[model samples]
Target: MNPTSPFDAERALSLARETLTIEADALLALRGQIDGAFVQAMQAMLDTRHRVIVMGMGKSGHVGRKIAATLASTGTPAFFVHPGEASHGDLGMVTPGDVVIAISNSGESDELNAILPPMRRLGITLVAMTGRPDSSLARHADFVLNTAVQKEACPLNLAPTASTIAQMAMGDALAVALLDARGFREHDFARSHPGGALGRKLLMHVRDLMRGGEQVPRVPADASFSATMREMTSKGLGATAVVDGDKVLGIFTDGDLRRMIETGADLRAMKAHQVMHPHPKLVRDDALAVEAADLMEQHRITSVLVVDAAGHLVGALNTNDLLRAKVI
Candidate 1:
């Protein structure tokens, strides 16, 4: 924000390192605080049939939102409800069976405390995440997962730097523990993140994005170079497979075409098999698209032949298909 300030790499690096060391110490200290209260909180979250309603104020609220998202994506049903918003008609989001994770570094957020009595009356289980175990919020909570930090990374020791980092790390610990307890797998994670590249890599098979049937460029091994070029051009995939009945004899790519021309091979007299790569890269239709992409990268090829266990060409695909699917 200060345009007049000078930029110094060494000073910036020193400050950044100090900040990291402070936060890292805070996180390390959390390991010792993971006692019976932490286990009890995890159990309550796991046993909740409804959902985990996370509540916090200010910086704690920011950490709580990310915590809730981590829980939700990692197989726990969770959502963040701003403590300030909870009093203003957002209390309806909490139900009788739901579990509440109330977070406060001071354990005295007025808005969060304001809704606790009614929440208790509604018979909802309350778990507190606070730095002050003796504070009012802890006294009202059924279980308290203390997130106490020695001090903030801020030079003033007043900002929520180290404390917020500790809180987020604690939330991640809960998610990872619940993930293991619930038998969550990679496929389950992929299902939750279907729009992401990781999901595409984990879930998409070759058949899911391959060009099959007529869209595949194919020509007979005995076909002339002109016919092969026509097939490649029509498909616009930069490659074509030379087949003998259902079997793949060879492959001819645009690269192969260039080599043929450079060598001055008489195109009118040459056959498809004459200049084609005898052993073209092949992948199974059931193989993962990520595997296909790896194969292409390893072989330095633009396309691959998709076949079955019988070694019959069923389809084909180029890098563009993988790119469009976000698999590469």
Candidate 2:
């Protein structure tokens, strides 16, 4: 590497601040540029029977890919197609009943413009996203989304820094607008992103993380205190449910054992029901795991019994179970 002069920290910080200010101002200006054309474009996309096709060149293409992804994940079917590739044979992907959003800063890209006429002939709805309203792309478009910026954030005023931010903002605006129009909910978004954190919170149920069958610590209501303590110790849940058949009658925990010992109670003479706490906090089996976490947090308890609609003790879960499931 070649040697360079000493770096000026103040100058670097000043430039970073100026770059952010320029981009912030550009977005502020773009906010006022929202008009009927944006609404028309959104309506076209919403009414399309097929997918929304996004096309762009250079930096705008990167923004186009993100726009398509956001739209697809938020209930609108969309994808990105490179303009240069469309000129070869990718243009065949454009069919009738689709909405095309072509993005360009100057709105005069040769590769993008070359395929515009053919896309028009195919009778697809064309929406032009550009800074120049009078460019070739806008002329052929059915609707125009103006993403004009006062100047580039680059020191030379050449690179697409502020312009790219404006494009991204516009794309997000459209995706959110369509999301609202479709009445899309969190579950819908989770369905598309099943591998994400939101999916685990929304899709996973208490039964999925609860200890069922033999894993549950339980004993009969008529069992001796020692047997109940043995059941609790063997299951390692620090607690045991006192059940009458499948019905949950009460619960006994290590805390109860300590309290009974402190009170000088006759421990060897106590039955399971005599020592257990009745009406313990319970969670439904089909409840969301996050809901179980909420129940534990709200009650300030470490564990809860899982029951069915008929109030039968089906399983049990503790803070450790929720922690292992990453629901806490």
Candidate 3:
């Protein structure tokens, strides 16, 4: 009997590197091949009033879900349906006027092909993404977006690495194109991602998170330090707004009080206006909450006065408020 030599670690590492290199090159080649057919595919879906139904089988199904999510988040309404389940009644989820994006590496997944006739009969636009342009699904599609790769990243060229990456990239291209066509903006994206930190930063405004109305910790500029301290303490904001009539004159914070004490400034004789840093930084109620945070950091301050167009103090907010609102 012949004895087999032990596997070489270096050879194994070299093979892995070669696989990745080949797949990366394949994706670059795929990028150059994108043309008018891709545009037609995007236009077909854009023209439809109904949602985009993404369908695939096996590994393609996993990629399809991610593609559907990306499209939905970027202003194009889309959802994923497993091809295998479509035969068992999930096909009902698709409707006429909808766009169907069927994903298959070989373009001949039996499960996905089974639903084509019904989808066609319902007048749903079919766009196929496949490695083989001549495959059955592509031939039946209204438009075919080629996602072909010369080989897979697996040593035996069996795994779906290169194909899956190409499909994902193609999906991203479709989403961005549709987003541009629809005039989708940051606000639209924020509306879709309300639970994310980016969403909070973009969607939250000063008016939404600020302490307003009677809860505003404010004092007349002519008021004594003792009175201002009482208002700040009562409000639990660790700061008080100093105003002359409705105009914000300055702010007095816990830091200001500590500094005054260190300098032996007599609080009993001092008025709020005299001790306050006059003309302190202020933000408008309509400003993005993230901008307020930037302002606070820029001025080395913990709180900011929220004012109206005429410079009247309408609200107040602190770093703590931003933290609580998850805008930090």
Candidate 4:
């Protein structure tokens, strides 16, 4: 609050760097603080038969929400409940089997502390995430996660900058440990976040986006070269599969036609089998859509024929199909 000092760009930059440095140091210090207590807290959460309820007040509440969300998305079931609301019948949400994670920098937020005794009496496990291990909140807990920072990043040492970061980091640490213990995989994460890009890559199968039946551009092995070109043009997939009784024999593409014309080959007399590229790239109908994308990219091809377990042509898809579905 210097009234006489004017705005200086260098000062602004210096303060920003200082704040980041302080926060970074605080996070690094947290690594050493992770001891038996953290393990105990993780065990308490893992052993719980019900949800992990996160409770906090003020800035700590904001961090708690993110922590709860991260925990939920990563394989743990959790939700944030405001400490102030917990006193007014919201505490009823806490069942006997649930574990509660209470966040407070001072370990003595009046709103949060008010319900801790009742929660303990209700036979729910209490985990205190606090900067002060000796505070009342920590003393009443079944387990304590000490998130103490040496100092606040704020120049006045008043704002909850460094302290909040520590709390969030601690929450993430617990969540990740629990995730690893449960053998959580990307597919599991995708299940919780099905609307995200990773979900599309992991959950979407080739059969989900592939053109099946009549939509598939196909021609018989004995079909004339002109017939192949017509199939490609009509399907607009840039390629056509050569099949015999549903068994894929080969593939013909616009590139193949261009090459035939460039080499002065007789397009008029060629059959579909003669002009096609034999043993073309093929993806299984049950394969992940991202796997199809990888196959196409690796072979420098734009389209791939989809087949079932029996090696019979079931459908087809291309870069456009993947693009349309946002799979790629």
Name the top lDDT candidate: 2
Per-residue lDDT of model 4, residues 1-328, tens digit only: 6899898999899989999999999999999988998898899888888999999999999999999999999999999999899999899889998999999999999999999888998899899999999999999998899999999989899999999999999998999999999899999999998889999999999999999999999999999987888999998989999999899999999888898899998899989999999999999999999999999999999999999999999999999899987888
- Whole-model Cα lDDT of every candidate shown, in order: 0.92, 0.94, 0.92, 0.93
Candidate 2 local Cα displacement, residue 256, angstroms: 1.4
Candidate order by lDDT, decreasing, is 2, 4, 1, 3
Candidate with the larger TM-score of 1 and 2 = 2
Task: State the local distance difference test value for candidate 3.
Answer: 0.92
Candidate 2 C-alpha lDDT tens digits along 241-281: 99999899999998888998999999899899999999999
* TM per prediction: 0.85, 0.95, 0.91, 0.95
Off by over 4 Å in 3: 1-8, 244-246, 309-312
Ranking by TM-score: 4, 2, 3, 1
Residue 203 local lDDT, model 1? 92
The alpha-carbon lDDT assigned to residue 274 of candidate 2 equals 99
lDDT of 4: 0.93
Q: What is residue 138's positional error in candidate 2, in angstroms?
A: 1.0
Candidate 4: give the clashing pairs. Answer: none
